[model samples]
Target: MTGQVSVAGLGPGHEAQITPEVSAALAGATDVLGYIPYVARIAPRPGLVLHASDNREELGRARAALDLAAQGRRVVIVSSGDPGVFAMASALFEAVEATGRTDIDIRILPGITAMLAAAARAGAPLGHDFCAINLSDNLKPAALVEHRLRHAARGDFAMAFYNPRSASRPDGFGRALQILREECGPGRLVVFARAVSTPEERLAITTLAEARPEMADMRTVVLVGNSHTRRVGGWVYAPRSATVSAPASDPEGDA
Candidate 1:
């Protein structure tokens, strides 16, 4: 398979956060494919073709990258954060699996995801056990989101949430905040890291009682600390270790 398809992460809005491996993939790519804003990060050069599409077209975009590779084009699918983390890598693999394509070289180049970036900016709230949850209900049922939130809270796991709000689903985040308040209580720390690493980046650390739903938009990544999470100075973090406790049962009865 001379033709290759590389799924690369551009990191969270900053060129500095992009990994060297992803940079190499982009350099060698003949065709770059991704969402409009992600693709716009790449500079136009001779022999490189840019294919920008709208959001919510992951399958189509993945297939297009695969088809281009089949035609001997060195294609790279760019994702804003790590392609593996709720990004193009999964969609690309899904397309490859469905097609049973064994004739093309496929590579997944990882990048620093938004959660990690946001966590770093917020002083390591994910220093201990953590779970990353995508709060959007576009692909999954809304009930599952609440279920996962409850489980994560019951597990006492630090959580990083993505896609907290969007124009079509503004109420979902508010409901999520409500579920968190019910489970984690008012004193739990929440960090709203908006546009991390970008010029418009803003970080707000507050307790659940003080955290308003309006603080988070689509660009924001919200982090909720476990029961033991606390602030040292200006930073919030969960310690590396925690005392063992009996596992909490799910509030919802098993069917």
Candidate 2:
């Protein structure tokens, strides 16, 4: 009895946002593994076994899931949003590569990522060319983060950021805001969508000049608009067309 593993997204904390494919995977899974909060989203049932681990244990969790699947147990790994976007699907593949376990069955299911959910809730801030970047320094360097920010701003691409700040890195987001202000100028639109689709959801719209580091935390997704992004009525959106601008230069001579 060969078993399979499915990496599925639950879609940013709303049960309604969860797709039918993910729901069906959960219903048929004999074992589910994920971060503590994500695994908690799965309901307990007669034959389903849940394995919850810490946020930093993604590789180990993937290995455990693969191990279970190799033993003929149907497994599902749940991520809050789309598994491939800064989530478990990549980690699972990394584990597969490291272990050379190409024989195990694997499936990647798509779901609405937090940035998209946030963008939708706010209107269409991502309506134009955009890029998503994770700001956490857990696996990357701070200099690299600033480098990407500079390029994104220079290219005038609408930007979405995940893991903007946390208690441990209290000042990183402040520094990021400073870089954005330098490259994009003071009037560029910025939106902070926190816990979108949940009961405690909050949305704040402002500009690079007024954006405070305190407005964002680990749970918040920050959106910085391109030069052409603007507010219409009460909603914010980027136009579908692009007006190329000269390459941006740092005002402060930091570059």
Best by lDDT: 2
Residue-wise lDDT of candidate 2 within 12-120, one digit each (tens)?
Answer: 9999999999999999999999999999989999999999999999999999999999999999999998999999999999999999999999999999999999999
lDDT for residue 26 in candidate 1, whole number 0-100: 89
Best by TM-score: 2
What is the C-alpha local distance difference test score of each model? 0.92, 0.94
In model 2, the runs with Cα more than 4 Å from the true position are 249-255
Q: Give the alpha carbon lDDT tens digit for every residue of 181-210 in model 1.
A: 888889999999999999999999999999
- Error (Å) of candidate 2 at residue 188 is 0.5
Poorest lDDT segment (10 consecutive residues) of candidate 1: 246-255
What TM-score quantifies how close candidate 2 is to the native fold?
Answer: 0.96
